[model samples]
Target: MRKSLAVLVSGYALAGLAHAMAPAAPEPDAPRTAPQAYAGLGVGLVDYSGGGSKASPKLFGGYEFTNKLALEAGGIDFKKGYGLYIAVKPTVPLTEKLSVYGKVGVAKSRREILPIAALPAAPLVRKNDTGAYGAFGLQYSITPNTVVTAEYERFGKKKESGAKEDVWTLALKFFF
Candidate 1:
């Protein structure tokens, strides 16, 4: 019984010494949720329901009001067309370095149907249109100020062909 008691006391003392010698934990830096402005560029493929696809590039910028919300505006290049959009962006954090975000709002597009070589006359094309826009994406934070993302965006119906425009892209975003 005396031996067991001595051993128990020694263990407790050793544990206490180890705890006292351990380094203190540092406080974490400020949260990324603070309001910030950001910009991004993406390259992707655009597919149209009417029957064509092309490589597309997009440019965008926005202000994040919080970790969960932001406002963004951007432009995209499509096959024989182009689009500009403004959206409300909402985010869901999945982990310390990963998140899913969505964009919903309005879009303006201009498109044309090129005339065939054998065609006698060129078809008139619409210069501008206003419509709905949407998108969803996943982003992995590479640093507090940078993230890499993959997204799919849809610029709603085309009035000229009654088709939809969809884009899939990989992007890099920077926060300031």
Candidate 2:
């Protein structure tokens, strides 16, 4: 009786270990979620404060590790100039389909200046500058993988001319 009881207890212990090592099953009724990575393209108007306003185009990509945070990088062509930027975005959800976010980053920009023919010595100017950038935006999810956003962004002033740039953009993003 004692030997039989020991064998039974050992069998139960091995069975418990097997059960603990088994992989968990996924829930079939879980809600759909967004992908971890995405890409976006946008076009809008850039207002160079006290300078002028012109059409601008931008391309960007990002990765979301969690629902509330992401890292992004992009390039923008603003009128006669262009810039490359990288930013961190922190987001807050207001509803199931709407959210707000803020971005802070750094940018490297190249500005082209036309020659001043009226001046005594007419010379073309090209300047490369680097500065901080910030933005705030609202996003609405049209589908699990698509989002639309409207945002306002500000680029820091140029080192030489102290001129700042701002843009208002509408963007569409897709996650894969």
Candidate 3:
């Protein structure tokens, strides 16, 4: 009876130890959250259709309403002109750190042309135009609040001179 009692106590202790050593069950998935609003500045080289490329600068800001949708506004100096644009950006995430997006928007552009040295009699020309624009880009998140992008954008033809423009840019953005 004494030996049986000792064996039973030892078995109970070992069972309790096993229970304590077991891994806990996995927790349920957490709810998803959208990114916060952000603002950024970008500078890049703009390639003009008519000739050479030039340095371009931009200021932009936006809010992400969801993981896939956002609204943005920006001002850009596109070499020969300057424009203000508002766009809807729809994004598709390929991974936690990478995404592709499309931009569709309208812009108001103002262009100024100075008289050429060969044409002394030519006056300075100023024109204002409004048009639709589109862009597609790949954004790679470098951190929670910073991203880098490579994009191609096209602007509609100028109403006055029937000129169109395109640019390829690499940009860095920081989110607030």
Candidate 4:
């Protein structure tokens, strides 16, 4: 599931890139949308390849360079630790009020497992790693400055030792 999600996101991003870079006939007087900043809070379930699933919260902020392009940075709670990421978001509008987007970037994460109460003799376990991150999501506009989003994000899918993670969320995003 993780591998296939990666492939799908990678393929979509590549295709978007190819289309963006290709020359095209200029449209007549397309209105330029100004760059905007946005922030969001998400609540959802987080699943780990090692640890069990748990409810989690995520916080994110970004600057959209255009209606179709943005740079975003966000953090997610992992109970034992946390994950942070920065990604380039490319979006495709499906309608006047809906869009699909993909995020591709780097994530730095760390997880620490404390000795269990039943195993006081055991040592604490710590894992730190930096890896690729990807996400795919949909957005539906509620007002000019507000939208609701549903997303699935993955972190450190090919890690050598640390836990791999997934987050599924429904969130509210506000633009300023």
Candidate 5:
């Protein structure tokens, strides 16, 4: 009887230890919409790859209308030129801290070209063009409200041999 009592106590202790080591179930319905709307401004090199690079200051704002659809706007250079785009992104959460998305949108560029003094009699020309833009980027969310992203964008526009202007840009972005 003494031996049996000792075995039973040891079994109970071991069972309690097993129960304590089990992982707790995560809470359900914890909210996941924090990455929805993001707004930020970034000052970076705006490379017109084929044209010329400039010190570009841009304002960016995005609203995630749904998990897959978003509308984003960027205004740059004292609003001399602005881009408004609506895109559908395939977003996949790679980890708790990072995500990847790809988007395709249509963009328009409008700019005022100052008349050169050499051609003082030349009329001022304000050029406007419309094109499509596609972007692919990786985003890191340090916190729910802070994010940094690097994107490669291709803006498709072409100018004739003697055409007035050609504009395309690639940039990196940061959002808070």
Candidate 6:
């Protein structure tokens, strides 16, 4: 019984010593460092929209409002009568240089389609358009504000045509 009592007291003393040597815990209300903001410009080609395959150029700009939130804007074929869009994205970082994001946006597009002609008739083209779309994409940031992207976007059907515009694109982004 005496030997067991001595061992119990020694164990308690060792535990006390270990506790005294441990580091202090952080305060619960301390402010942590904020994540960096990132912005960029991008360009790419879009296909599977406007009634057929078309080569479209795009430009993009974005600001990271927080680590997981961003606002963006840009146009496709800005120099011509092309599609225009603006979007907001929620991004989640999966690694130091990789993240995935989804986008929602408004788009304006103007497209021309060739009209079907009968024999001995002249071929003509007509214009079709949409003023808005829902956009979505996945982004892989090679650097802090630059990314390689694959995107799919959908716009409401055009007037007088039971057709919707949806395109898949591959793009490169550059940070500013």
TM-score of each: 0.74, 0.73, 0.72, 0.74, 0.59, 0.58
CA lDDT of each prediction against the hidden true structure: 0.82, 0.78, 0.75, 0.83, 0.58, 0.61
Local distance difference test, candidate 5: 0.58
Q: Write the per-residue lDDT of candidate 6 for residues 24-102, one digit (tens) a residue.
A: 7544432212544444444444444344455666666666667578777766652234666677788777765566777
Model 3 clashing residue pairs (backbone): none
TM-score, model 1 to reference: 0.74
lDDT of 2 by residue, 3-85 (tens): 99999999999999999999874344322344389899998677563566676888999998676888988888966678777
Candidate 3 global TM-score: 0.72
lDDT of 3 by residue, 114-161 (tens): 567699899878777778978899998887678898887766564433
Off by over 4 Å in 1: 1-31, 48-52, 116-120, 158-164
Residue 164 deviation, candidate 4, in Å? 3.8
Q: How far is candidate 5 from the true structure (C-alpha RMSD, Å)?
A: 12.1
lDDT of 5 by residue, 1-176 (tens): 99999999999999999989988643442224545676776653444423455655656777776544566766555233444455556666778767778877776656555566699889766667688767777776655556677666544465322122222333344433
Q: Which is superior by TM-score, 2 or 6?
A: 2
Ranking by lDDT: 4, 1, 2, 3, 6, 5
Model 5 segments more than 4 A misplaced: 1-31, 48-51, 65-69, 78-80, 114-120, 159-176
Those runs of model 6 whose alpha carbons end farther than 4 Å from true positions after fitting are: 1-52, 78-81, 119-132, 158-164
**Clashing residue pairs for model 1:** none
lDDT for position 29 in model 5: 28
For the record, the alpha-carbon RMSD of candidate 1 to the native fold, in angstroms, is 11.8
**Model 2, runs deviating above 4 Å:** 1-35, 48-51, 158-164
Model 3, residue 13: distance off in Å is: 41
lDDT of 4 by residue, 63-163 (tens): 99998999999998877788999999999988878899999999888877666779999987888878899999999888777889999988875544334
Q: After superposition, how far is residue 98 of candidate 5 from its true place, in Å?
A: 1.8
